[model samples]
Target chain A: MRLGPWKIDVEYGHLALVIVIAGVTGFYLADTLQVSRNINNIILVVPLAMLLLGLCLLVVTQCIRFRKHPVQKRATQLPNHERDELEQEQSPMDLLHAFLLLLGVGALVMSYPLIGLDVATLLFMIFALLLLGVRGWLFVPIYAASFTAVVVGGASRLLPYPLPTLLF
Target chain B: MLDSSAILGAISLLGSDINIWLVIIPGLLIGLIAGSIAGVSNTMAMAICLPLTLYMDFLPAVMFLTAIFTGGGYGGAVTSILMGIPGTTSSVATTFDGYPMARKGLHNEALGLALMSSVLGVLVGYIILLFVVAPLGNWVIRLGPAEMLLVALWGLTMIAALGGKRLSRGLIAGGFGLLLGTVGMNTSGYVRGTMDIPFLLDGIPVVPAMMGMFAASQLFTLVGSQFLIKDKAARRADYRRVLSGFLSVLRYPFFQLRGTLIGVFVGAIPGVGSSVGNLIAYAQAKRTDKDPDSYGKGNPKGVMAAESANSSSEGGSMVTMLALGLPGGGGTAMLLAAFAMHNVTGGPQFINQNMDIVYTIIFGNFIQAALLLVVGLGFLAVAGNIVRVPLTILIPSVLVLALIGSFAVTGDHAGPITLFVFAGLGWLMKRYGYPVAACVVGLLLGRMVESELIRTWQISGGGELAFFLGRPVAMAFAILLVLSLLQPLIMRKFTAWRTRNRSA
Candidate 1:
């Protein structure tokens, strides 16, 4: 990962992500330019153009950096010890856990409209506890249920409107 | 406006009302506790307690809610400093330096600084509000759409300055955020970026998005850590150190005053209030400081500037609410509701006819400001213990709060969904060298800038250049903007020249 006294340790996956994001933004900007000349459209186009420019520059710079540091291109595939010493070790399990928690949160949100707030919250809380590395099956339900009840119950009483839910 | 009879009436009204005194402490305590929690907002606390106001007399009801407002103003700083999760938008900039200070084992000091600055800010804000309620209203109204647009632009320049070493990366993140902000429907009935999603017609909710980016993403970064502060000794709260931190604010009276001024003016502006005020004050404090580079890296003054500006904005926002009957934001909206419940109307006529009531409210706020000093110290002492909580428990618990909080914001699933999506984006941005702060700033200013720009264009009949040229206030703001953009480079070059001269 060391290239001419500069240490670069970006993974290939992250680099590809940068390219993808930049490409999407650039595409959006081009599409927006063709829309119109109204005040609202112009307002939208200016910042979108600026954003695309910034993203393109970022992608170009990152590409140039990678080009300059050919040896660092395969830093993600480095032998374990070398990678560990150079970059703070993030295990694949840790990455998976984080990603799973995120997915669980998304699921929790999407399920709310389907089932209801109360049920969705109860289910999500338990799922979140598991994803967050909570153990003891007995405590999980107890904690999730009570937490859901308090939040959902409080919102029901205090907020101006009833929180949408299928099952109370 | 300041007739002796009015002053006497105000004093007598306040003195006769034992009920007003009774509710102040309890209301403040509720606010402090609710605000101290990561997801619980002052507005939420007030909303929960709003029904209680229905039973009380008019002055006591308004006084009670205002007490909660004052206490909650400082309450958000606790978690922002300790956990890097801003309990409210007002405390967002506080996270920049305050959290770093906490990580460096100065959590107690940051809390004390925030509290003291808040107390002073509220005090100064009320004092200014008392004298200039009418005049200030007239003055701020003179700000045209062009001027307001410049104010938002002024905020954006800070993004480049916010990016520590990677200015370009910060600009990229900020630009992306600006683009993201424009995703929903525009004022002109055109929806550009919302892929035909029905809910997005109203645009992405800013508060939930903010919580996900700053709070949840930050928690993700802190995974595997047992304690927030790595230093064991720094983890414990020291009362003496807290006292020392309280005393530290006196050393920078000018900084506090500057922040107070910024807060009052910005807070008076309807729609854009304390949220923008705090950021602008922090940026100004950083830009003017001798060691501007030290800001956002555990600097005490940064905490002072943000807290002072935000707290003082309460008084500024009140000016519009009381004198103009315009609710500035959520908290003030609650206050306006209280006014309605009391069978009172607040406008120019209200001030003219009910000067006694106006004086009483201002006087009550002064008392609340004094009480904040005492109640806030104890609250800080207890809230500072958050560092001792292990990450395993703290993370899940805060996540729960954040989820519930987002849910409360929209009273729908949209809030949590936005939080989850943005949390992932924020995590990745943080993982890279992109300045999340810049993106946040961009997100906040994006709508305001565009709206103002459109308004200016409409007012000018498409002659935007000539309109801006005619507006002296906008011209002044433009000059300020150019100076702000050039200041850092100018300072750096000046310093280099001085260094060369010294060496020679």
Candidate 2:
């Protein structure tokens, strides 16, 4: 896959996921073992984490082997063809849209307490709508505000706990 | 098991109360709304409405709460079918086929199947409860920690089936979920994965994390789509298709029966309720089905199996609460609280002394189940319109609703934060062909798996292999688990042998 001057391999994403799992599991296992070497305490965590780590290693090895002999693997495997076909079907722009939507959701959640649930929600709505190609300046804000009001207002009244909000 | 005097007493009690009859509709509606929402759970809905039951008499209050319980059971299927988001944990399996059906422009049928299955599940569950509440309660109580651990393991087997063709990815996702599930404090006071977050002490909020993984992550992937159903012509909510779906459930009576039975047995066990019951039922359905590959790809039988188990599990959970005074799960716990409020204790004594009241509750649920068919039909008419909404509007709106729903669940920023974090992980997993459903199941059962294992170990006096041999129930479950795991292979071999023999 190419983007401007950069070449990207989608296989790296799979490898990255494996690494994240292994890293998190390893750190967690170390922390758990540090807390206690008792069988009762570590029984589940130890074996499960080790299994996960082992699986991660297995995945990493497969990725490395595949990369090392891409041509041979591509020739032998049928799933690679299917996967490549699927990759072709999904445009780079679609990936960008997904990434941007994720970023938008993250920002909304992070700013929730500071900016208030209502404001954060409003901004997120507008951002998301525009990002998803909802045009017209007046229509976007109107939809965002109405949605925010109904959800936030109803939530405030119905919920036992108060929601943090700068605007009603 | 059938007491004539109790039956007479139950009939008289039910006939005497107009208030009880009146509360059933409202209770069902409340449950439906609460259960259909992205983040709000049935238990949460019941808890919120617990106070309102104060003004009513004991019978009415109990009936109302149970009504909500029954309603919420089916309500979760609505969102699960129309959108990919399961309104409650129990409905997770519903999304497996329900969402796919929705995407295929068969949302009406899916909704209908879910509704009919849920109704029948409730009815069958209550009927079983009516006859064998005492025996079932006794059977459930005998199940020790080892048995519970086996049950959790049974649920975990679902990961293998859910993995699709990629067994390795499925195992990795499931293993990662198990690790994530154990992030908070362990049963033995060992905390490992909290990372200093306060909420981590209790463990990651399962509901919020679940919403993140299934709902938000799914929404992100839908960014490129114009609508949930891409075909504009197919997006119409046809009542005829809905009716067809409803009647179609009868075609798989055995599947529905199997699911209901699984739900009852699984639901009867304390702490393991509809959530595990639905998954186990779905797994069994998939394992037994001739066309297993059709599952998770808009198979109506999958929806029926899941809905039946989850809805019927409500009745199964009620067995412990009614006969043993033990709450099987959170919703039953709320019912027990209602029991306490009325100065009523649930146990063998309660059942022995107040058989009439027990019969009344059972009979009342029968009516609730029947009424659900009518109420659910009306509810679906309104809720089915969700498919018509364009993705441009629906995606962000649902995402925001999920965030708020998560916030409502946690009552703090932790919920929203967890939602965002898990959403990213869910998206990555989805992108790379890993099963997010497997991960969600792992996370859901992770804590239970650990606690039950620890208990089993303690009972065995430092994990002695001999300890399991002494327990026949545990041994039986182990055998069942082995058989369940190997059934696919055995079936394949048997088929091959027959084919070869035929050729000869």
The model with the greatest lDDT is: 2
What DockQ, between 0 and 1, does each candidate earn? 0.33, 0.73
Worst 10 residues of 2 chain B by lDDT: B157-166
Best by TM-score: 2
> Once superposed on the true structure, which residue ranges of model 2 sit more than 4 Å away at CA?
A1-10, A65-89, B483-504
Taking the tens digit of each residue's C-alpha lDDT, what string does model 1 give over B332-367?
999999999888988889988998998899999989
For all candidates, what are the clash counts? 0, 0
User: Which runs in model 1 stand beyond 4 Å of their true positions?
Assistant: A1-36, A63-96, A112-168
Q: What's the lDDT for residue A56 in model 2?
A: 84
